[model samples]
Target: MNDDRRVYGTDRGEDPRPQPGRVYAELVGGPLDGQLLDVTGWTPDAILDGAALITEAGAYGPGGRALYDPFPGDPSRWSWSGDTP
Candidate 1:
């Protein structure tokens, strides 16, 4: 098992306990070298007693673009919100 764990937000804030809604997802294959690849995005339900799409299927980032702009590894590379990349 790759044992990959990824989450955009934490349960303490994003998802409160007691599970207020029902979630859904569609799983794609994994990455090479035994890496676990999973993409997730949620949609809120608008109606009464109706919940949002907790997880949308195929909502992952586009692949093959080689977009790897990550958080600045060096403090010098980092910039404030007011600054441009």
Candidate 2:
């Protein structure tokens, strides 16, 4: 079995934090509030486009998606937009 315990920006090792050289985007609000998204190696355009993050704690609950957009003027943060079915 794989012992890698990396999830998002967290690691289950002795140092359970974001490692060096890895870029992360902070998720603001929504079900994934405070979570980090690994944006390492992502292009500027891709970051601007944002992402539809999957969440079980969505508005409709289970199997729903949470929409997040890049916070304008802040490339390191993603703000909650809405929820989708």
Candidate 3:
């Protein structure tokens, strides 16, 4: 299995910026699928950085550009309802 860590950000090397219509990324497919990746070590803001962790694409593990998937809505709010804060 691919044990390498995945970082969420932009697929392109450009610095990440959040704006209307802008896209962000997280890992999809393979072993890391559906798991939240912690990228604070490299990217302090992680997904907010909008730059690929591995610029070469597919340079490390099984995933490359093809493995990049649109980030699903944050799961932290999944269990949150009108109840508890």
Candidate 4:
């Protein structure tokens, strides 16, 4: 479990609502770079596997990994806190 979860919010001035059937993933440097991927219906495990193929699937740090936060909030979101282990 790592406290490396990223916090997403309206700081970028974008709409805060999450698109249904998709989850946002922060893209790192590369093609489709610095963009957020709306991972369509993909679970945490699926994202990890698909990330290798999907350039849209990405993370902030070196590992290119993350998990969605179970607790939903307004204008903000968090990744799963304990999955980093």
**What are the lDDT figures for the candidates, one per model?**
0.23, 0.79, 0.33, 0.41
Worst 10 residues of 4 by lDDT: 69-78
RMSD of each: 16.6, 5.8, 14.4, 11.4
Estimate the overall C-alpha local distance difference test score of candidate 3.
Answer: 0.33
Q: 1-85, model 4: which lDDT tens digit per residue?
A: 2223332333466654454455566543443333455565666655554344222234444444444432233212223432221
How high is each candidate's TM-score? 0.16, 0.78, 0.22, 0.33
Q: Which candidate is the best by TM-score?
A: 2
State model 1's lDDT. Answer: 0.23
What range of 10 consecutive residues in model 3 has the weakest lDDT sum? Answer: 76-85
TM-score of 3: 0.22
In terms of lDDT, the best-performing candidate is 2
Residue-level lDDT of model 3, residues 8-38, one tens digit each, is 4435874333333323233454433433334
Model 4 pairs in collision: none
TM-score (C-alpha, index-matched) for candidate 4: 0.33
Tens digits of lDDT, candidate 1, 1-85? 2223333223454532122233322122322111111212422222111211122222333321111111234211111111111
Question: Runs in model 1 with CA error above 4 Å?
Answer: 1-20, 32-85
lDDT per residue (tens digit) for residues 1-85 in model 2: 2223233435356454555777778888998887778889999999999998777798978878898889999989899999998
Comparing 2 with 4 on TM-score, the higher-scoring candidate is 2
